[model samples]
Target chain A: MKSWLTTTDHKRIALLYLGTMTLFFTLGGLVATVIRVELATAASDLVTADTYNRLFTLHGVIMVFFFLIPSIPTFLGNYLLPLMLGAPDLAFPRLNLASWYVFVAGGLLTLTAMVAGGLDTGWTFYTPYSTTFSDSHVILAVLGVFLAGLSSVFTGINFIVTTHRLRAPGLAWLRLPLFVWSLYATSLILVLATPVLAMTLLLVAIERGLHVGIFDPEAGGSPLLFQHFFWFYSHPAVYIMILPGMGVISELVPCFSRNRPFGYGFVAASSLAIAVFGFLVWGHHMFVAGQSYFASVVFSFLSFAVAVPSGVKVFSWLGTMHRGSIWLTTPMIYALGFIALFTIGGGTGLALAMLAVDVHLHDTYFVVAHFHTIMVGGMLMAYLGGLHFWWPKISGRLYSERWGRIAAYTLFIGFLLTFLPQFVLGTQGLPRRTASYPPEFQFLQGLSSAGATILAVGYVLPGVYLLASLVRGRPAGDNPWGATGLEWCTSSPPPPHNFVRPPVVTDDPYDYPRAPQPTITGVGDA
Target chain B: MPEAVREPFADPAHQRDAVALGMWAFLGQEVLFFGVLFVFYTSLRVRHPELFAAFAPRLDWRLATVMTVALLISSFTMALAVRFAFTRARRSLVLALSTTMILGAAFLALKGWEYAHHFEHGETPQIDLAGLGRGPGLATFFGVYFVLTGFHALHVLGGLGALGWLAVAAWRTPASDLRGSPVMAVGLYWHFVDIVWLFLFPALYLAGRLAP
Candidate 1:
């Protein structure tokens, strides 16, 4: 166990990330519960305004930075990239370990800030308020975020290098798995965008700590500049959070559908397209914040343009399931759920991209509903799906398929009930970041709070069953899903060096027809 | 003698390629890291041309020019170190790396001196300087200046540390034990740091002078 502490293996580092991220996820979820309970009524009867502010801020910071951003890339990407590529480990194994430590260090610093006083400036940390007004641990929180950004940058470097230099022979660019391509696109965004976020946060810290006027209005600096800097990194950051999840769905859809992806080139290219266009649409976030109309128009167009790639991916996944022997496995159910919910989320996003509509919806619960649908419904679903899909290979054990399917469906339903009301409430004119709302919005808020309870149950059920499986589950074979990646070619819970014999990729990925003895087993038959 | 490949790489050449590619990717990230500040600086300058004109004369351009020359020399020596490592010239490798480190240290010293001069003149980031009034423009200028140069200096310090490590390795290790890839990687980083300074010198010092 102590050796595990100092291990530089990418697998161990990935486990480290998984453990810590789970802790943060629970913490963030608990905070969300508090916010929901408070909003269960029409008034701020549960917690004080200050505490409410802190609760939501902590929830956003923890969920966005500690959990979601690193969820797929750091944990799943770290665990599977080398295995999928048929390599011993990442190119920089030591750096991989270092990134985990850095992530933990950042999480600890932010936790310390929370325990000490807690930030109330929200996760976005808009200037003037974050710089001059917020009487919270702003600098400490910014520093924490800065450290986490550093970890992200290091992980990005590792992924990009490993993908470029470590692919098995004959795994040509065209032959690579969509998941690998998505990870590569994600790495591109993480590498390019995180540094700007770091510098932006550093500027915020400097202004707050040193009384220097970088973004403070009283100091003659434009607060709008801060928004530009923040959203410039943050908009691409949305892709950083979702692209890897998209990758997981790409892998899961093919394996469960028992067919090749409909248009692999289009899907893979779209990930890169999203990454590039994700950077240009940050200004849409600033439309009502006093940005020029021309800039907003350009950004609105770009935001809609970025959604095209996402649409391509969705169509490709649907195309994959067409006329195929689809296995309704737990992972497949989650992937299917992701497609439905992500479409709603993305459709709302397109609506929000309109300069006219966004004026009314900018800070409303509509925007909140849209993002939660995409992030929680889209990203978290894919994360759970990928986790279940790879659990056999990861732990050398089989979980109860019945319980897996139950949790997936429950989560999808619970997520819808939770966020769909918020969209209605937003159209009814209830703004976000408020502890209290008009009594008319209470019914929808109640529905949202009730749905959150179900969502919590949905989230916790998997934890219980997954942990139970670790102890009493049956042993699993290497290719339990009949997956056609290099990872499946190795043993379940692969060896330290990943492969016994170095794999040479002779065929394109997801070549289901060419697989020896294609056994499309039921989810129950392990 | 052909060197044995490290774990995770199939051969020595593959390992070398991976390391070099990783460093270049990292350098690309650094470009964006510093690039944001340049954007901030440009936006602020455009917003406050008069304030920049007033404060432009306060910066010590002569000292900055000297530091730029030192960094360029350091980069030259770093390239030489990579060349020597490739040829298995251990003594020359040690010499070139040491020279790079010395020049890097000189650049830092000059930067440190410039910072001290600013502090003495009350041109610090924390307070409104003597010549600059209480408006945010001049203070913003100095703040940007400090952060830009401060981060650049940290990179130089990191480059120096990398150079020192390479120097020691070249000095103590056998030719068989020395890896040319690590040397070249460090050299790439050193040159990147130098190039960033090239941008910073003009952006911080010369941009203000051109402010109308």
Candidate 2:
């Protein structure tokens, strides 16, 4: 325990992040389950309206800041980035460890705020209501989030420097695995955008704490400016959440299909493109928030522009799989799920990007469903898939492949059952963030609530098996997947120094075989 | 003899590159950190152009100029410290660093005096009822002013801590152990804080200077 606390090893830090993030995920997911149960009837029966507001706010904050934002990058990226690049650890190992502590401290502080009677201004925390009204623990929550943002900035700086300076001797930029490429791009967003969010939150905390008027319009501050500043960091924040997940699929698709990712350069470029285009489109979120029509038009157009790079990535993934040998591995299953859900989510985002459609759908369950599909369906699946894919490398034990498939399928189906109805209810004009809704929406809400059961089971199954595997499962060999990345060449649960010596890259990433021999491990191995 | 290399880096040069790159990445975010305030300030200017103009002369630009000069000189000394560290001149490095820190402290000292000046004249973010009734714009102008300078001061304090740490390291460690990269990293941060002040002075003090 003491070693875990003091170790600056990136691998251990990755596990540290994994443990805390998983705890937060369960916390957030539990709140979500309660939310769905409350929605099973249109009566606000499970939680009070005020309590419901706080609950949803807590749910969004925990999941976004604690779980999803740090999910793949902190753990998966932390564990793999060094190994992938053939470096012993991240460029700044101590900084990486420091970020985890900061993240957990931030999480704890936010939890304290919840215990201190919870914030009700929603996760976005728009002005006037957040600053002037809504008597909750806004200052504590905002400061907690600010600390988390600082942690991300540190992680971003570490990743950017590591990627730029720590690659194995011959691993040129173009030769990088798409996962590394995506991470590099994700770090760019994290470095540039997360600070803006911190500053925005500081402005929020200042107004609330000092009774100042940076965002309070009654005191000559424009409330709309708060929206502008908030979304400036936030829209890119969603990318920070998803791009790393996309990085996961980019690896999974090629490895499972036994082919290099089709249009590797485009796949790599698309990540950077997403980062660049992400900043230009924050205005789209402000379309209905009293921003000027001219600004909205430009924002709406650029918002649609973001979809192009997204489509490039999707088509490239499908193309990589089109004629290649395919495996029905658990990670592959989750990757396919990610592609489907993210596409649907991105498609809806395009529809919402349209000024007229957005005017109708803004603040409705449609927006909620859209982000959930992208985040939960897309990012969450990729995270789980990557975890399973790297499970052996991390723990030196093979998770039960049978259970893995079962959990993946269950989670995918459960996610669909939960959110698909919301799309319909959303278009039917059911507003979001309310405890009670029209009785006509009860059936869909019930269906949604029922799906939470499967999601819980699916979520929990791996937790049990993955932990049990650590103690009792089959010992995984060095290259269980026959994957060709530098990480695969290293031992399972690699040494303190990742490699005996940093391996030099001699070929492109994702160099694969058409009719490859089955990997050393197989189904039911555990 | 060169400084010992850290793990994950093969050589001192490689580690130096990483430190440099890391510092730049950090400063990149630091820019956005202050960039938000500038963006908000610009948004305010757009919304209340005349209000900013009317309040511009209210600030003591002469005091701001003195603070600016101190910061600019400190940045110069910081650059010299970086050069001295690279040359293994510990004494010169410490002297240059001490000079930078003193200049930084002087700037903050003057800034505190300026804050007291504003407080005495009732030009503070703490808008009482009368200030609010007179004009919220007045309170908000002070609000933006204090936040802008306050955050900058916090960063200056942070830089001072870094510089002090490096100064002690330079003073105690052998010339070989006192690596250039840490000194360079802190130098980068100090210059960044200086550059931010360069922008902040113009935006806060000068943008409204020529107004009636």
Candidate 3:
């Protein structure tokens, strides 16, 4: 534990992040439970309107800032990046350690803000409400997010450098894993998107404290300008959440199918395409909010353009699964679930891309369902699958495959039951964020609440089994799945320096059939 | 596999490449950071042209213009310090870094004074935009200007502290030695801060200068 706190090792730092993020995800999940319980009835019986508002804000803030943003990149990417590149450690291990400290400090600040009369403004903190109206701890909450933004920027810098400078001698650009390529793209968005959020929030703080009136609608400030600034970062942030999930999917699908990822170049380029196109489409969020017609058209067009690359990725993943040796492992079940659910999410996103449709669905449960489908159902499944797939490597032991399979199926079923109804409710003119709704929407909300309960069980099961693995499960040898990445080419829980000597990659990742497995004896057996 | 592995590189070339690439990525982010504010200012100013222009005259243009020049001079001194370190001129590098830090400090001090003055007279655009439509539109302009420029001010202060630390480090360890390579990274950061100010100049100070 002491080593966990002060260690400069990237792998250890990754563990530290994973531990904290898991706790935070659960905390966010508890807030979600409250949200679900409130929605179970048509009236606001569970909590008052103010409590409800703060609950959703806390859930969004904790989940988005604390959980989703760092889940894949910091926890998975940080562990795998240096190894895949065959470097001893990150460009600066001390900086890597410092980033963890910054993350924790930021987390503490946020938790402190939560305990000291929680912020009522939504995660977006839309203008005058946040700047002029809110009497809660808006300044402290924004400061927490601002500090977290710095940690994100540093992580981006670390990854960009490591990917460029630390690849093994023969690990040419094309030879890199599709996962690495996707993470590289994700890091670009992180670096570009987060600083804007920092500045935007800093402005909010100034407005709230110094009476600068940047977002105060009554003070000659355009609240819409605040939205523009906030969404400019946040819209790309959605990609920041999913791109690493895409990275994980890139690894999972190919491994489970025992094939080189079909159209690797396409999948890789699509990740980059998503990052670039992400910036242009933020105005889609502002479509119903009185943006200029020109801006609206531009955003609509870019939103469609972004979907093309995403479509290419969906095609590529399916293409990889074409007539390959498909293994129905627990990880594979989650991957398949990701494909189906993410498609639903992505399709709804395209619907919202249209100006007419977006005007109708803008603040409805449809938008809520679309994001949850993509981010939670899609990205969370990918994260869980990756966690299961990499569990052997991370914990040096294998979780119960039987339990893993049940959790995956339960999560998929539970997720669909929960959010699918929200789509119907949204289209039926049900607005989101209300503590109470029309009585007609009550039944669907009840069903969604029931699903949420199942989903919570699904989420908790893995936590229990994964912990059980630590104490009783058989030791996993290096390269547990017979994978081809450099991470698999090292020990399960890799040495402090990551590499015993330096690794030199000689083949492309996922070249399963023809690729020579390194004939090391203790490769996958306990 | 572990037994087959060898030393990846002979020297620290990998480390150098990593730092260089990392620096470029950070600079790219800096562009986006300033770009968001630029876009916001451009959009709002275009929408409320007269209101944006009206508040510009009330601002202390002289103080803003002076700080811009101070920041520009600081950039030159910072570049010279980088040059001195590269040429192994230990004494000159330390001296140049100190001068650059001092210049940076002066810029922040002036900004602090300007902010205090604005706060005292209640000349803030948020409250004083009566010439605009009403309070809201005028408030938006001042809100953006204050947020954008105020955020930039924080960066300036942070840069001063970083430069001061570098200057003190050079004094302790002589910049000619191989120990001073980290200073180049610090120099890149200082220059980046100065460049942000370069953009801030036209955006904040010159918004109303082009009125017909």
Top lDDT prediction, candidate number: 2
What is the per-residue lDDT of model 3 for residues A150-261, given as tens digits with 9 covering 90 to 100?
8999998888877877788899999988888989999999999998998888778877787765555565456898888899899999999999898888888888787889
User: Which pairs, if any, clash in model 3?
Assistant: A214-B143, A219-B139, A220-B135, A220-B136, A220-B137, A220-B139, A220-B140, A221-B136, A221-B139, A221-B140
Candidate 2 lDDT at A128 equals 81
- Write down the lDDT of every candidate, Cα atoms only: 0.88, 0.90, 0.83
* TM-scores for chain B, listed for all candidates: 0.92, 0.93, 0.83
For residues A1-526, write the lDDT of model 2, one tens digit per residue: 9999999999999999999998999999999988988899999887899999999999999999998888989999999998999889999888998999899889989999999999999999988899878899998999899999999999999999998888898999999989999999999999999999999999988888887778876677888888888999999999999999999999999888888789999999999999999999999988878888999999999998999999999999999999987888899999999999999999999989999999899889999899999999999999999999999888888888888899999999999999998998889999999999989998998998898888889999999999999889888888787787898888898999999866998887787873234455666221
The residue-level lDDT of candidate 2 at B62 comes to 91
Best by TM-score: 2
Return the TM-scores of chain A for each candidate in numbered order. 0.98, 0.98, 0.97
Error of 2 at A170 (Å): 1.5
Give me candidate 3's TM-score against the actual structure: 0.93
Write one digit per residue (lDDT tens) for candidate 1, span A120-150: 9999999889987899999999999999999
TM-score of chain B of 2: 0.93
DockQ of 2: 0.70
